[model samples]
Target chain A: MKWIPIILIVGLLAPFSLNTHAEEKSSEWVKVKGMVCEVCAYGIRKSLMKEPEVQDVEVRIKEHKVKIVYKDPKKSLDRVKLAQILEDAGYALEGEKP
Target chain B: MLRLGFFILALLGTSQISVAHPVIFKGGIELQGETQKKDSAFSTTYTFSPYWAVAAQYYEMREPSMSPLGRTFEASTVQINHLLKRWWNEGSQGNIYLGAGAGVFAPQGLPSEFLARGEVNADWESTTLYVAARYIYLHPDFSEDVDFKKLRVGFAPYVLEQEGLNSWFILEWRQMNTEKAEVTPLLRFFFRSVLFELGSSLDGDFKFNFMIHY
Candidate 1:
């Protein structure tokens, strides 16, 4: 009975505790290539939305740019992982690697 | 005004935008439908690669039809088109596309035949103004070939969102084969995934066109 009470309390508080540890604000302006049409913009946005860390996305069709905001202040995301996600969605970075 | 406009597009489409950007991006699916008088067609295209796409279209005539097979007939087309190249100038925002398409014309009650198509398209756009022109040729096995052309100039009176509604005022001219040219000023509106155009020609004829992308 004692173990059961402790386990219940820990399970209820784990998610809330984890949320407070790595609270960081990060934003990046991703220059995406081959976005000449509206569908291209939509597809890029949709693919970026799949990232659990991503909280906001703005796609500029004419400029071929995608602005992304990722949550979690302490832990920054990997640029290579972001590039892979974009490539799988049928697009590439505009200027340089990552 | 119309004659001056036509001359400008003819000059620009021949030597301009085609040099900038040629092809749209890969991984796009477009569905288009057009109805004129008693004839209508539904077409859908899926881009399989960066510069290649397969298109399927079904056209039908309801009444007073002028089809190669008969007055009333149904036809379908399956084509594969590719963007050959694109050109962009040092300080230009518009691009040009040159593409070729080869397809089969399957008319009901007749043998399926092959057709070849060549098209040149150019467009220049800004925050408010958009101008586009395209010339297309369809060469069939029979003498019933087609020279189709389109010119459109649009102005946006309002700002639009990516996932919301956008509206534009477009003046368009379309010529189909040997018929008289049709000129209309239409209201072009689009949401995130759907586009609709409605207008009327000077002769009181109404026009409706729709397109969807996924």
Candidate 2:
């Protein structure tokens, strides 16, 4: 039982440290094209809001672009799904390759 | 009056400095073809409309052939509409409006003294208020010396109307000393404020129109 205290302390501290690291994760900015008008932008914003990991969506009508920030970068988002959201909202997605 | 209108818009914009309005510049292009029992005609039209202000619309139409051998004619018209609109049920986001306007038309074959003009329209929106029924009166000639009598009714509903896409489906009936009817459905797409429209009229004619706003 001599090493029991040290092992328990390390086990507890490791999880706590990992929790801090997870909380410190920063989101990346994703740019989307063809986001024109408040109506179109609002639709995308609403659809993305359903994802718990999504933090915010900002659409610039003049530039026809959208900037999305997510809370967790590790969460895999389906690009095709996002593209479909845009298409249904009456916009053509661009700037995926370049 | 134009300056006063501009000033009012400026004040309205300033008052809502932190908020955004739904108003935006709009334009439309139309291609129409009509054929009676024996005569068929084709025409292209362009129009520009400002948001939240009275719109002065102009149209130039041409009849490539009016007779069996192809007698051609051209006509032009200008309309000024003073529109008053109201939006209701913010949650539903629907719109209803009643408006009246006047217009003047100069056709090739009609006496210039019998000028044509007058219009009234009422509209309702389900998802977006884009279509309406309009009644207009036109005198085929109005030169400065003669009084003319003509009236036309149109059931025009916009197929698509947003900041980016605008289209109209129009069916018209006329009683200008005669009874006639014309149906047309127009499809238009807008990109960068430019509009391209394709239309088919009941008279079994097809046409296209392209327009840009500067």
Candidate 3:
């Protein structure tokens, strides 16, 4: 009978923890060089979307930036892999912002 | 007779200007087609890397009454395109490409010949403006050599976001070896990975081209 109270409390807190984790799934903004046209944006978007961790991608040609949403927030952004993807897409990664 | 053959060959070999990029992003595939009055060309390219691509091209020139020996000149070549240089500027991009190919050239009712091609192209473009130039040389084993030079300038009416439909108006000038030059005004539109062009030369010859990348 005593264990039932602890079980009830843990169940009550589980949803809150899951919500916090979901909120932590953050988006990243990356500055890209040579992303000047729609075609260039398409290439970058297509390449980034191939990564398993990337959930969504948006490219802004005017600002030369790419916004990436990750499927798993706990996984850190691999800058080396990001740079390789940009290089393969015929662009260069200038910097990143949180 | 030889002079007439040369003239007929030159007439059949009209402008070969393609508005498509020869080398695309890594693992990209591009298909392009262009057609005019006397000539039509189709090509497929695969880009293994950002800096290099391989393509197979088929070109045909047709004129029945003008040629004494043949009605059509057909060439099928395998080409390699190298991105020699690229510049990523603040609001624009520029690129230079060099390409070469060799294949069989066959004229109807005549023995097949060896054909070789060399080309250089350069382009610079921003969201609002674009300029490009190209030169191509064709050498066949048993015929006079042919060359083409082309220049183009274009402007967009309004700037649109990446996902929006984009349109541009362009003017093209082409000069073939020892032949009269032609001027064309073209409309270009692109949505996503598909691009198409429509134009008519000042001489009233129709032009159509399309490109798709995947």
Instruction: Pick the lDDT winner.
Output: 3
By lDDT, highest first, what's the ranking?
Answer: 3, 1, 2
Error of 2 at B138 (Å): 1.9
Number of clashing pairs per prediction, in order = 10, 12, 0
Model 3 C-alpha lDDT per residue in residues B26-71, reported as the tens digit of each score = 9988777778886777777888998998877777777644332336
lDDT of 2 at B16: 8
| TM per prediction | 0.65, 0.37, 0.82
**What's the distance in Å from true for residue B191, model 2?**
4.4
Root mean square deviation (Cα) for candidate 3 = 8.6
Docking class of 2: incorrect
CAPRI band for model 1: incorrect
Compare candidates 1 and 3 on TM-score and give the better one.
3
Ten residues in sequence with the least summed lDDT for candidate 3 chain B: B6-15
Question: DockQ for each of the predicted structures, in order?
Answer: 0.07, 0.03, 0.43
TM-score of chain A of 3: 0.69
Q: What local distance difference test score does each model get? A: 0.59, 0.39, 0.79
Q: Which lDDT tens digits does candidate 1 get at residues B1-214?
A: 4323322332222111111123333555666666667555565666666556665555455543344334443444455655554332211235465666565544445655576766677777654677888886667675366566788888878554444666889888877666667788888877665677888877667877776666
Question: Which parts of model 1 are misplaced by more than 4 Å?
Answer: A1-25, A31-40, A50-55, A60-65, A71-98, B1-25, B60-75, B85-93, B106-112, B161-163
Q: Which digits, one per residue and each the tens of the lDDT, describe model 2 over residues A61-89? A: 54445666777765535566665544333
